[model samples]
Target chain A: MVSGIREMKRLPVGIQTAGWFDEKDPAKSFRFARECGFESVDYNIDTIIRIGRDEAGNSYSFMDKTDEDLLQYYEPFKAAAEVNNIKISQIHAHYPTYVVGDEERNAYHIKVMERILFVSRFLECPAVVIHPTKTPDRGQEREINLTMCRNMIPAALKYNVMICIENSLKRINKNVVQAIWTDVEEINWYIDTLNAEAGKEVFGFCLDTGHSHIVGRDVEMLIEDLGSRLKVLHIHDNNGTEDEHLIPYTQNPGNKGMGQIGWDGVIKALRKMNYEGALSFECARGVKLLPEGARREGMELISAIGRYFRKAIIEG
Target chain B: MKEKLLVGIGSKELLPESNLEDNLRMLKECGFESVIYSIKENDLKMQANRHVYFGAFFKAAKNAGIAISQIHFKYDEEIKECNDYIESLHNALHICNTLKCPFLVIDPIQLKDSVQEKEINLKIYRSLTPVAKKYDIKICLINTIKCAGGYHQHAIQGACADAAEAVWYIDTLNVEAGEEIFGFCLDTGCANVTARDMERFIITLGSRLKCVHISDNNGISDDHLMPYTQTLGQVDWQGFIAGLNRIGYEGALTFDVSRSIHTFPEEVRPHAMKVIAAVGKCMRKSIEAES
Candidate 1:
């Protein structure tokens, strides 16, 4: 009977898996995500790759596993998603893709990212967010990031998963300054140039609202400028200073129209551009702020805000 | 060589429960040499004979071998009345005297216009001079950021964010009081949030810096994270150490990293505090190192 009814277009609301669930059990995390009204989840693969050596000087990285073993390790996540009926919207790749002057480490990161693309495909995720390399020099940052993305094209094409470059911030002389891809035109250029080189759309933009807010960029303008090239979103809010990764509307509760990110403008712009990707929340701080007993309430509140965004974007 | 700074933390997270005796003992167990007592309105209003609870609090701190270095008065923007705010501060001074805490860190009230912000805060602090003098507590004005919504959307300089202005306020207030009654507490996180050069700010404050709120951020928001944990080099630890060393800062290395601690899983919080203490020791050593 429902098949005959015309269903309205609705964007899926999602959240990250970092803080909401037990890392030991993907099933529990996915189930919790489902219960919290999230239709999809952004799989956090950052945990598997230890950025630095442990206290004993031992390095741990799941990317070093054989393809078969890597897939086997993530089998539970796939099974959990199937059982929970929650879509795997995207996977977050380990950050600092290009380490300045550390060619050996940078090569290792690319290899890890190539493996991450394979994992993303296996998990049925359509995209992966890779942070841009940060440095004081803009030209050097651009060249290194471009080379890094170019190196990932083979893996991206093999896995059929789009590479998403996020807007990022840098610290210069103890100040928060804009990094490469923070400028809308530069981001557009990266995506377009990568896609052109790949002979297809292999690259897309992941707009991190918190990053944009801190860098003093207009969220609405960024969304509109990216247009169809925007494939993913890291929706979060802050008081325009730190990257707090807080829930939207929580920043300016008094609605004084001052220092917080303008979620209203964000929603309107997404609606105008007809953004189809999930309104995913990368708000780990939002969940962590609450005590363990009350973390579910935080997740539920974020999900409620996600639903509000979904309603506005769809109904408008 | 300069004396090593004592490591301490705010009582907000350490004192999760109401038992002051147990809380002070827990702080000592966690490797803190000192603490900043966070006084709330409830604590002020509950005690009709205020000395009863603070008396026990003082005894507990002494017994636990923890020094009560400073007291934080709850600044409520909701009160909307100057007299009520002053009354709460007056009560806080009484508790500070009982605890024998020397410094009281108070935030400057921010308003839309700079003149109004300065005038209102000056008036409020001026009103507390009499009570502060009676308690023999040096009132420390902390730097704050203004987050006024609209075209200038993000955080800009707020009350006392600038070192020159903070020095002006302290000097002016002290001259008006006919003694050294006012001092400055440099909140590193607030300074980082506003993107001020930590070394320059510290150098400017120099001997006037009575205390510090040592925390880090991503240079945008006041995340209050531990130093050197930020992915971006937002807080200049080298600059901070250099500035403190140059000034020979003798106060406690007090931290306000509840947000950073909360980021970890509940079970890992104890370990997190230990790491923070370890970092504090490292920073102190670095500051005292002959450079």
Candidate 2:
């Protein structure tokens, strides 16, 4: 019941798993998101794509089950999204596609991802997030990242899921350094090159607010830079240091001295770009760390903040 | 092995209202032989001349019987500009030199890409090598837990979370610098959360194990509780002591145990300091027995 400005261009407010939803119980989390007034939810696909190896060293396939069984597996997620009237924003895929010396593991993972794509498509989720490749050597970074998408492009096309490459940051020597796909220039190049080669919009960019904050990237400027190509968002706030993933403003507990990310500026840029995607809050960890009794209230407050931002974007 | 147990406490425990000399006196009175100093953001920001301020702070520590074993440059999260970051790092090195502290512990910020992480970390650390060498202080990169939220969002742990990565980072830095300039600080809480076996990690780091943050947790979030407080899901103390002995670690057994003590009522911290001193003594005894 977190009602705000009623307008045709009102961007729908969304929420992530937010640590309240146990992976085993998707219904409870989605229902909570719905009750909190979130119009959409970014489903964490990591729980579904569990990759394990047997004694024979062959990868155990979750997809090897009967189609009926697969339907049963997806029943909870589908029912929750339907009953709560929540749209599935995107399935955040397992990151670092190139595990060091684990080609079999990566291959097994891609197979699982292919199955998730089918489930995502069925749920009408438009996008899925896969991280850019991380290698020890910088020279092979671009090629490795492209190859990952190249291999999965056909599956993505078949399932009609747009793979969104998220911006990421690494902690190096106590300084937040930009990783692959963090730079706007690199992201533009990667997205442009990938989509051009695929002959369609198979890959796009996911702007992670916390990742941008930690590396000192201006979220508003980045949004403006990405413009129409930015398909998704992983919105969260941090106090300029460690990815604390706190709520947008410095309103939450335990954020006395932390830096506040500028949400108004962010909304201004999104409004300028006429962003049509979900305004999802990836700020779940901040609330999850609260005492159990405070969680529901904390979640409501976060949802209210989301509505506030949505209202800001619409009013502007 | 030295017959006397050498122990220290994080200077973060010292209230900002209180000056260094009074805190050092209190530490000396509490039986802490050494102190691990921390340079707060405010301390650097408020002071017009930081070098002079640090010099005076070190003078006060020397006046007391407390030796500064390590200086922690409080992690600056707002440093987005490279020039600002370098300036802060230089200030850290300057503080270390002023205090004549042997080790400076830091939590490196994570980059998105691993290659960029290695390249950027190497470049930054390499730039600081001369300052470290000139001051005769070793730079120790500490391990970190997952950023804000656990695993879902990609918050890169520092370039040295894994044992092999730590070795490679330190070895490569040292080899390039043509001197043993860098080392690793293992945080017990971080190790537990990351599922890193402390014994094996110690064995891997060997001589590169420069400093340590000793605290207990439930192996989920970083609780930073007093040792043995969390009886369940505690770190393998037996293995921890054994590994230190195996590596012939002769560094100070500093208690990064702050949350537990800091959370205590202000009036009760004095007694808590004594308890920390006793815990440090007991751990040293156990480590010595293993040796």
Candidate 3:
């Protein structure tokens, strides 16, 4: 009985399905992400992108209304994910849709957030994930961003959804998270302050392996510092330099790599933190695969991940 | 009546080890009569931007009783930095002035669009052309493709029996590019994926070519599989080499397969050779037909 108990204590992966979970699959890809042993899955929230004008001289609408419309696009995908028992976790922050200025615009953003929360609740998800903004000129000038969030959190609370602010890797010349919070130190302070002010856990942190690696932090150290407060753990490999986003044990298998984040160490770190989420993979494999092939590859990767986790962890 | 073409396995085929002596010895054992030396950026950094491979290449070629066919200026995206471009030029000029190879090979990064491609192409000439002319070494460009710039803008289409129209695109570019711009280095796996007729393309190009990146492929796609892997890349091995014979083609035959020797070494290079020998059977037929 004790031995069985010990076996059950293996890797308590607190992970979500990254769209890139299946390096190949683009369509039906999320299903593959679930098969990769990820407990949570993410989707492009606020996908009503205003790309450009069409021949009719109207804006190109990305997300049309209605479950029927969504089902028409996601029928096979939803069915496969359901059969696989994969749960939805968070929506990538729909910032472009949710700028709070006018009452009507703010109300619309609130409606969108409510709809997202409804779908997530129906899916039995615990939280919604978002990237707040591109890094601003003054790193960690969270006053403006905080004021906006302070105003917005009430609306989020009304939906009973926990918002998980994920740290984004640098783009071009800036790390997106720092524009809001200069460094991890400031991020920790903000989380502590926000939690205290709310008198409840308003938001939590999503630890992205590549982002941490890029910033020259030991990812294992982060798990150690944040402990159980670390909610969503994004599991992906990068070679310290550019975010190649490859599966573990594939890229530069010999050297410590640029990110200096090795696979075995990361798995061991996850176990150490006693994380209770999904180990999401957002990595690059190849670009040229057909959508079907891409999704199928995503499925295979998840199962392989399960096997790896099952082997790496030892329960108490 | 034909040159028993000097086929080489480039240093890249045997990576991880930068030792020219050891690589040359292996090349000899593998019976590759020619070689295209690839210099890595790390080598550039550690060796202080010296043309270490160039001197080693000349010595190894003579010692191994092999011919130095082409010196390749390896590509890296970071070459946009002036220092890296200078380092690349140093290596290229090293081969040009020091090594006995008659030609220098440069494969510029595939441009994403014709606009950036024109810019990069101009960048390529602006930076490297004078260097090639300075060393008096004939410069040749190779084509490749992906989602990026027009490198492999034309993909392989096995549907048509070696599309002659697509093959001419490369020949025409070679004509337009420049002086000392010797010709094309027809990569067969590239042709397989792009679906250009190998023999027909070469025949059409008619001797403007300086080299061949010999590799076998599975018919399904460009696997760069060892010849005989039942990939689409398999040619009548013997007939293929013999066809080069028919064209009176005399240049380097280098294997440009992309797998790292450190990981899957034992399987790939030797298989490349065995596939060549299998293809050699077809070349025998071509020889007999000619005779």
Highest lDDT scorer: 1
Residues A195-283 of candidate 3: C-alpha lDDT, one tens digit per residue: 67666676777777777776667677767777655666556654456555544432333333232365566667777876656555554
Cα lDDT of candidate 2 equals: 0.74
In candidate 1, what are the lDDT values of residues A1-316, reduced to their tens digit? 1010012124688998777667678888888889877888888888667666567744447688999998888899899988988877878899877778777677788888899998888987888999887766768877888899999999998888888898888886766778888988998988988899999888988999999998889999999999988888898877676787876644432323334587778889999998888789998986665334345655766777787787778786
- Give the winner by TM-score: 1
lDDT values for all models = 0.79, 0.74, 0.53
- Model 1, B68-149: lDDT tens per residue? 8899876744657889788888888888899999999888887778798788889989998998888889999999887856
Better of 1 and 2 by lDDT: 1
Candidate 1, residue B130: lDDT: 91
Runs of candidate 3 with Cα error greater than 4 angstroms are: A1-40, A46-80, A96-107, A135-140, A155-158, A170-182, A253-260, A284-295, A314-316, B1-291
lDDT of 3 by residue, B51-127 (tens): 56457657766887877777777666555665566556656666567876677766645533645654555455455
* TM-score of the B chain in each candidate versus the native B chain: 0.92, 0.91, 0.73
Candidate 2, position A204, lDDT: 81
Which 10 consecutive residues of model 2 chain A have the lowest summed lDDT?
A1-10
Q: List iRMS (one decimal) for every candidate.
A: 12.2, 14.9, 12.7
Q: Which DockQ value does candidate 3 get? A: 0.03
